[model samples]
Target chain A: MPYAIEVTDVKKTFSGKQEVRALDGVSFNVEEGTVFGLLGPNGSGKTTAVRILTTILNADSGSALVLGHDVAKQADLVRSLIGLAGQYAAVDENLTGRENLTMVGRLNHLPKSYVAGRAKELLEQFDLADSGNRTLKTYSGGMRRRLDLAAALVARPTVLFLDEPTTGLDPQSRNDMWEVIESLVGEGTTVLLTTQYLEEADRLANTLSVLDHGRVIAEGTPAQLKSDLGATVLEVGLHDNDDVARTASVLNAIGPHAPNISGRVVEVTVDNGPVDAMEALRSLDQAGITPTTFTLREPSLDDAFLALTGHRTEDGDGEDGSAAKGSGGAGDRAGQPESATVPVGGNR
Target chain B: MTTTISIPTVTGAPLATGVGARVRWAISDTLTVTKRNLIAITRIPEALFFSTVQPIMFVLLFRYVFGGAIHPGHGINYVNYLMPGIFVQTVAFGAIQTSIGLAEDLQKGLIERFRALPMARSAVLAGRTTADLCRNVMVVIVMTGVGFLVGYRPTTGVLPYLAGTGLILLFAYALSWGFALIGLSAPNSETAQVMSFPLLFPLTFASSAFVPLADMPSWLRGFATYQPVSVVVTACRSLMLGGPTSHWVVQAVAWTVGLLIVLPPFAVWRYRTRT
Candidate 1:
């Protein structure tokens, strides 16, 4: 099947006193009806790529095709085929939720009667029917985010571009958004989602791309990328700090080379986590380096991100933290790895 | 041999769309957006009060306080004379609301939402301009009512009165376009207000909205006489008060058309550049 979205050698540069290359020769394809995630850190050009694809910001160079129309030359056609829930709550605060949705429907060239019906359906679907008459300013952050999403879907666009849709919502709201996104894809709406959250990509995306510094460093199915890295990580922490190095050396002996130590924690990647854990424990006992705690589990998307970016996903001089905060907790929600407590490195 | 039934399927031809259809689409979208703006005016009554009521109050204050001190040889009542000037002044003052609304919309990310939509890129400015024109009409109505109450009568027939009103509306719409441009280009709402200051004083004071241009010093009179607002207000006054209206009417229409042609594209350009 033809791709729903195709971007070829896209490059965008913001020129001023200080020139910034927002996107540099970025290229990717999102299959039709698939949930595609563009994952990146703050200032990683994910939003820029999304913006260019959405026809809001023209790419300085490159060809982007959405629904068989060129984005730069046929922007209006591209816009009509796609719906975008921008990074910010771009809904009009002065207007009621129903009005916002209806406005979008009308903009999509739906007849007045159809617009009314679509707005009603969307309001009900998004669970905003109860407060549809209330202005957006009175709604909570989560409600606003949901309404923004609903507004984007008012036209029932074939290709939906959600740029950090659930950024600042509480966990419950994020889960609700996730469910909505899942259902959207189930109904055959191709989604191009950009987010800083790793789990979001893992859970929602059929295919995911890890971007850093305006380049896609990794792209695959979540399972494929995780398994490609080879071995699940088993994280072992000792109650005593002095035993960390000893524990690492013990695990290193068992794995022959994969154990790494950070402070009181020792991490080792193993093909068979449970069997390796048993052998490593036996070795630690002989060495008298008893670890207070150890757990083995599958590698997380964060681990994948770290492996690709060569740094902790959250360590970026507060820039990423602020960007995440600015986007409203969507990044942090996705940042929370589901297998968080899994011991690092027993699976080979 | 089995006979097969073959159904000929007919696909529809592409619709014969034109620029008119696109413009209509843009206008409809603009109206939809402006519906909320109109509702917002009611929610924030202060905007209406300031834009409409305060200007009328200023007219009353100026007429009673400063009217008798200044005179022209036409033997016209100060209030009657000031009505035309006040009409222009009120409409010009009312143009400030366009900037304020634009700034607020920009600050709130409303324009960004419109930008992402498939509607005409010019629809946002069009909607704003249309909405402000509606507000201008409302203000004009109230001003006219007050003028009637204060014994200011237009001796002309209904057609000329309507023509005079149309001229002011056109002039105000054009003037508001310039303000909208400033609002769209400003980095923030506060800065927009600051940026509009240079246009504000010169456009209002240099016009024949208050004192006659002939009463001013020679150099100042020359400038004021040629200012667009002066031409428009003089045209309005001539039509309403039964004076030679031809020269001023032509000048006023020309100025209105010229500004309308120039400013909207500039506003759209600024909007595109900023976004």
Candidate 2:
């Protein structure tokens, strides 16, 4: 089946006194009816890429196709087939929830009856029935975000682009949004989401692309990216900070690969599993280095991102030594060992 | 109060056929926005109180305080002469609200939502301008009622009175396009207010609104005489106070037509650039 979204060598340069290249020949494809994720840190060109795909911003070069329509040439048709919830909540505060949805439906050229009926259905579906008559200003942050999402889906778009939909929300609200997103994809709505939350991407996206600067550094299923790092990650917390280097050398003798020291904790990836874990512990015992804690488990997406990007996911800065972290899960463990590290964060 | 009960029912089914469907959709959407504005005005008593009461206060101050010193010996009562100019002034003042409204809408990201929709781009502006024109009509009615209570009467016949009122409404509507352009282009509400003041204050004061332009110094008079506000005020006064109406009436109509041609496109261009 043809992909729902295809971006080929797309480049966008925002021109001013100082020109910023927002997208540098970025390319990717999202299969139809799949939850695709553009995973990156802040200012990693995720929003710019979504803007280009939505046909809101014209690319300086390259091409993007959505739902078999060229984004540049057939922008209107592309827009009609997709729903977009921008980074910020864009609902009109002066309007009631019902009015906001109806207005968007009317703008989409739906029949007035269909607009009203669809608005009613959406209001109930989004748990906004009781507050449908209230002006949006009176709504809580979560309600407004939900209403914004409902307005985007009023046209029943086949492709939905959500840019950081859950940012700044409380934990409960974020979970609620995740549920709504899951149900949307359950009904076969193809979704492309950009987020800073590693868990959000790991929970929602079937296929994830780790974007840095303006290019895709790694792409695979969550488990595939993680297991590709090896069988298990032995994370050992040290009792003394001075024991980290000594512990690393001891684990290296058993595991072949050197252990990575993060503060008081030492971590090593090994394929031999518990046998390797026993051998490393015996070596440490013989060296008289008593550790604080030790755990051997499957690697996480954070580990995969660190192995690929050489940086943690949670680290705000994408420069040297900041491996993106958080969202530890093991789902599909397939490996693609092509290590190419581009510039961490360009203007785009 | 008569309490009449009617069953609530939904009307107007959505139809998917027609090339002009988006235009109709835009008109309806615009009406919804207008209704929301009206509801907001009603809910906030201060908005209605100020809109209705402010012009009446201006009429009272000018007719009682400045009436004697600035009288032109054109055989017309100063209040009668001032009534028409007040109508233009109130309507022009009323147009500023559109700018403030647009600026607020932009700040709230409502305009961005409209842009992303499949609706016609021109429809948003068209709907807003139409709603504002209706608001101008309401202000004209209220000001006309207050003018009568203050001993100001239109000496001209009903046709000329209607024509003059129409002229004021058209001029105000056209002026609103310029204000809407400012609202769309300005970076924020404070900048929009600052940007609007230079044009707004000069246009109101330099014209024949509060005083006769002939009484001004030669250079000032030359500038004030051809001002669009002056042409509109002169024509409206001619029709209301029974004067030679031929020349000023033509000038007022020409100014209105010219503005209608110029400002809408300029507003659209500015909107396109900003978005």
Candidate 3:
């Protein structure tokens, strides 16, 4: 299939007293009708990349094309083909929900006769029909977001760019947005979503690109990325510091990978975490090493991110990825404030 | 959700193709957005109330309190002499709201929202200036009624009276573009309001909007004489009070045209360059 959107080594730098490189040679392509997820944290160029692709911003070098039209040279054509819901809700506060949607419809060149009707249809679809006549200031945050998304869909765009659409939404609202997006794609709209939440990307994105410091560091399906990191992690904690080396050797021999240690804790990634945990404990038992804790865990997207970027998913700072780096014992202590000996990575 | 209506499942937006059709669509887009803005003005009772009342306040304050002391002399009634200056000044101050509204839109992402649509990009600016123009027209009417109530009369008849009002609106419309640029440049509402006052203070005060050119210091009078607001006020006075209208009309029209030529392109350029 021909690519619906193609970005080729796009570079964008914001020049000022401090020349911040907002995008550094980033590239990706979205297949005609698939969801492409761009995952990154704050200051990681996700917004910059979306701006360039949506033609809200221009890249300093390289090329970006939407539906075969160059974004820089043919911006009008690109604008006609796509819809964008920005990080913030972009509806006019002074206009009523229906008025805002109708105004956007007319702005997009929809027939004057059809605009009001179309606005009504979209409002009902978003479950905002009852509040259609109310001004946006009176709407709750979720209703405003829903209305903003509805406004973007007025033209029935072929490709949609949602830049962190659910960032600040409550759980139910986020799920509603997710379902709306899923329905859009189900009806043949290609979507490119940028997000900081790992669960959002895991649940919604068909393919994922992990970005750090304005560049793509990793790209694959969520399962593929997690599998490449390893199947699961086996965690062990010894009661005494003296038994740490023995526990590490036993775990290192049991798992297919080397054990990573901090203080009296040890952890290793293996193909089967439960089996590996049982083997390591048996070996340690024969070696006369008593561990205070042992457990297995199903690897999460956080684990994939941690393994690939060498940073915990919670630590947004890429330059200091190790700021919140914790050992198996640290994870145990952190997980339960009430007790220190509870097994970390508690899978079963 | 109820599906009692025909929901547009999947389709492309209709483009305004062909040269004539596109030009017509552009005008339509401008008018639609303008109507939206005008509706906002009516809905916000405080905005409408303050806008109408401030000019009334100015007429009363200057008419009752400051009229006798600042007369232009030569047997003209103080109220008649003060009406044109007050009316023109109302439009100028009324134009400031354009910048505040535009800046608020920019801060709230409405400008970015407009940028993404397929409409003619110039329509945003056109709609904004036109809505503000309509608001100024209403202000002119309200203040003129207030002017009549306070015993200000123009012997110059209806033609020039309408012309004087039209000229004030024209100048205010062009000046709106300048404020549009300021609005685009201002990052927030507070800055948008305070930042514009410094630029406007000199334009309105230094010009003969509320006083005569002859009452100024000689050095200040040079600018107070030929500045756009002064030229416009002079044109207005010539039209309504019946004097030599030729030279002032020429300069006033020239100033309005010059502003029209310069500010819109610059404002649109600034709008385009935003990231």
**Alpha carbon deviation, residue A243, candidate 2 (Å):** 7.3
Score every model by TM-score: 0.83, 0.82, 0.86
Write one digit per residue (lDDT tens) for candidate 1, span A1-348. 889999998997666444555666888899999999988776667877877787777888889999788998977767777788865778888789998888887876777887798788988998999999998879998899889898888777889999888787789999999999999888889999988777788789988877765667777776666665546788888889878777777778775446667778888767677888888778888888767778887766556656555555555423332232133121232343322212112243
Give the per-residue lDDT of model 1 (tens digit) for B1-275.
Answer: 23222211221111114666676677877888678677777777787877677777877787788877878558777777788888888888777777878888877767766776788777788888888888889889988988988778888898998999999998999988998987887767888887777787887888778787778889788889988888888999888887899999999999999998999999988777664
Q: Which portions of model 2 show Cα errors greater than 4 Å?
A: A228-348, B1-45, B52-57
lDDT of 2 by residue, B1-275 (tens): 23322211231123333445545555766666566566555556677668878788999999988887877677778888898889998888877777877887777666766665655666667667777788788889988989999898788899999999999999998998988998887766777778887887888889898898878899899889998999999999888777889999999999999999999988987765563
Worst 10 residues of 3 chain B by lDDT: B1-10
**TM-score ranking from best candidate downward:** 3, 1, 2
True contacts kept of 2: 0.35
Listed models, DockQ each:
0.28, 0.24, 0.39
Q: In candidate 2, how many Å is residue A337 off?
A: 19
For residue A47, give model 1's deviation from the true position in Å: 1.5
Predictions in order: lDDT: 0.77, 0.77, 0.80
Model 3, position A266: C-alpha lDDT score:
84
Q: What DockQ results for candidate 1?
A: 0.28
Q: Positional deviation of A1 in candidate 2, in angstroms? A: 1.2
- Position B90, candidate 2: lDDT: 88
Q: After superposition, how far is residue A74 of candidate 3 from its true place, in Å?
A: 1.8
Per-residue lDDT of A92-126 in model 3, one digit per residue for the tens? 88889999988988887777678888898999999
